[model samples]
Target: MQGPAVFIDLTLEDQAQELRKYFKSLGAEISQEKSTKGIEDDLHKIIGVCDVCFKDGDPNEIDAILNSIVSIMVSIPLDRGENIILAFCEKLTKAPDIPLARVCLQSLWRLFNNLEPSSPLRYHVYYHLVQVAKQSGQVGDVFYGVDQLKSQFAQCPPSSEQMQKLYRVLHDVLKDTNSELSSKVMIELLGTYTDANASVAREDAMKCIVTALADPNTFLLDPLLSLKPVRFLEGELIHDLLSVFVSEKLPAYMKFYKEHKEFVNSQIGLNHEQNMKKMRLLTFMQLAESNPEMTFEQLQAELQISENEVEPFIIEVLKTKLVRARLDQANRKVHISSTMHRTFGIPQWQQLRDLLGEWKTNLNTVQDGMVKVAQAQVELTRKQKAAY
Candidate 1:
């Protein structure tokens, strides 16, 4: 709870007095008449004063001052309110003190929340908020700020350049903190670009695909296929290459690489050998899922590796935890227990449905057995009571 209005008023009064002296030393004035002139003028003067005061003044006092100013600004006309918000945010981006900058950003956020969602100023405020939050290097702040910017773009629709900038910043931050989220955001940004500019969308899509494939940790290629820009490249060589990664085995990948060696080398800009290794792992996972047992010769044929390389490759696949299997080297076979599917498509869904149906049948059988046992016990109890 806050203190009484009198105390609040006193605090602002003290800060105002200190600000006036500070302004006077710099050959400026914060006269009482200026406060009474109009909200825009008052806001302008307050923003200028706060810009300087925030540098040297106590943080708590500056926060209180900013809160009071924002409260007054919220009640003004929309155009004036927007202009004041923009001005404040412009100064905020260059704020040298992180603590005071946080306080100021909080004040701006409070003001932004109070504004109607349709207000034009919301986008500008969100944009500046993202910029300031990025400078702060706080993950939570950057994440929330970028999300708000993205949401605002849906409503206001930023230009192609703005969309690109947001994507770059989001990618840079999320790459370190959450790689999966980075991939998701990259797809979303590509979708946005697809809608904004068709000519450049293909280029952006290529970049997204290259980045996804180049990252050693990213193995899921199915999500990229969902974007329209990517799908639009259906007949293109790149799309075919992506399809190879998504579901095709190592042999198919080798064939594609051999056929489009120049395109893969020049356009994709990835290590072909490393890609082949990843494809082999994914293909092994597929093999483990489809077959209960796979012979060493079958693995060698599918993965295109020699007998000497089979065990080491299997060990690598095992390390991924995508497959659980015991290698019977003496028998030259792999007895698969379970495996994680590389892609959860129609086949996987059908498999899940079948599994669920089997479980349901088993449950029904157990329930019937229990019902029979209960009936037998009930009959025995009835006979015993009759004898009694």
Candidate 2:
């Protein structure tokens, strides 16, 4: 909303083209107004005056003004999705001023959520919408956005829906991998699950887990059945992304692509040689479960590779710490230790949990045995004194 509304009257068909300039200037500023107070002030002034265009004015004139604002929001993005939702929320003090924008936002959100997880929009709009919900500071709204995503994922078409959903979402997200943004948004959403949490994205993610797990046929029966669902999405998506990197068109940054190509020759069974590295990465992850202590060299040795070749490969594995290492300085061996396997290599948190629980149980058992042994010793001493 801009100009004196006098512009609305001129309607010089030729100059109508320039009318968009006013909205563009304001649209540029929209990303800067983050907080509610900031958005409210600008929105108030703009709408207060812009309302005139809508007041008893021609429908097309009204639409033109509003559409300019809408168009900017649609076209621009901080990463993906409209960059202006926070600004919208900031300035949305007047319910009447926002009805149309809110409607459009909701509709757009629904459309993105309904697409496959591998959908290009997932990396674009759906991903951004989650961030918007986080920025909105409204728990219900954040979760609502997340729910739309989870529901779409959960209701994936029968047979191959799960695979397709992951397929659609993973590529773009991997391509546009601004991991900082993804990590921040996920942290914010996860933190919001508590009463203090206002992010709607977090709440909705929780709801999806509850609903999806309840239906055994559609969703995979796995660890996601418990408190965490992200575990499933992360591992599956990563494995898929690795597959893409291993493709003939290797990503520009893959330094070891050639070696990875050679190493994967026979390790990956049916997973084509193109997908060999990916399969090995995941296969090694699978191996970690049983022999968590095994080193990359040990794994390479299992594949009958030279100790010299093993060193460079281990350097790569060392970066992720997927396998722990120890130097056999004298004999020159590296070991992984113990994997404690699962669908993927076990997450550290799970191990911490098991260790803590076992510690408590062991302490209790040790205390009980000590108490019984003390009593028996006391009685035995009493009998020995009497016999003497």
Candidate 3:
């Protein structure tokens, strides 16, 4: 079994016979029930052989062996699937070779659904699934597959302790990698588990991912970065989140810097004027959106800026496309047709309520005018009828 080059050169018939012989050495029988002890020993032997086969065997030989194992599990009766699953888990747990473990993982996925809800092997399967994925440089695929299995095996919810373990393993996997794949996987997990009953482990996994994202050592402005599931975290939690990017001085924060400027200078310990510009620009836009016509004096008073600064700030906002307004220097006012609000809170909500109320009042007035016009028409028609 040391060098499988000879096996690769063999004819199809010879290779099939050799595969059967290898399984026979592991005491594999034709779909029969055996003692647990007997099965464990056989599994150990099979794993040892497969480990060598993957190392020394050619691609064709390894593929053939994997295909044969899958075929045996599939052809076996439903009752026998558990044995194969446990055997594969055993191999996965003991095998130090990731290549061999990945190969064995294929069979585990194939036979996973066959396992019952009460099967003890489910834990073992997920445990190794995470490990193999983390070490194999295919963390995304591994976690995704495990997530599917978790849904399938819905009957057996892990204990709180077990959930913690699951979360920790996933955290380690995400913490070690900073690729788009890792970020996507982390985002998916956060979206999946962000409820009140979300396990402590799930929360830990999210923290681990967000920490990695804001880490200077592994920061990337990936497309998935903006989709971080932070709705479940608010208030001080959001503030604490800002500290991660602030301390790292990540450029990724430049886009939404206005929203988190509360800590830009005070807590973040960064002496950058960009935050001031952002805050002022954002407040200016909010005021313009809330008002259709505003005098220069009002803008200055609202933004706490000088008259000279008002026009320049408005011009900058116009350049940024944050608001659509015409500055009437002669009239000393701005005519705003449309605008965008960057952040929403109590002030914005209150503005929206007031605007809605005003809209309702205007609509009522229009309707009353229409009624009055209809009454006038009716009276004129009656007079014309009398004249006829």
- Per-prediction backbone clash count: 0, 26, 0
- In candidate 1 the C-alpha lDDT for residue 172 amounts to 68
Error of 2 at 257 (Å): 16
Q: What tens-digit string does per-residue lDDT give for candidate 2 at 93-169?
A: 22233333343334335434343454433334443443333333332453333334456546332233332233223
Q: Candidate 3 — which pairs collide?
A: none
**TM-scores vs. true structure, each candidate:** 0.70, 0.32, 0.44
Task: Give one digit per residue, the lDDT tens place, for model 1 in 48-83.
Answer: 766766557787876676666665556557665656
Which prediction has more favorable TM-score, 1 or 2? Answer: 1
lDDT of 1 at 330: 99
lDDT of each: 0.72, 0.40, 0.55
User: Of 2 and 3, which scores higher on lDDT?
Assistant: 3
Instruction: Give the C-alpha lDDT of model 2.
Output: 0.40
lDDT of 1: 0.72
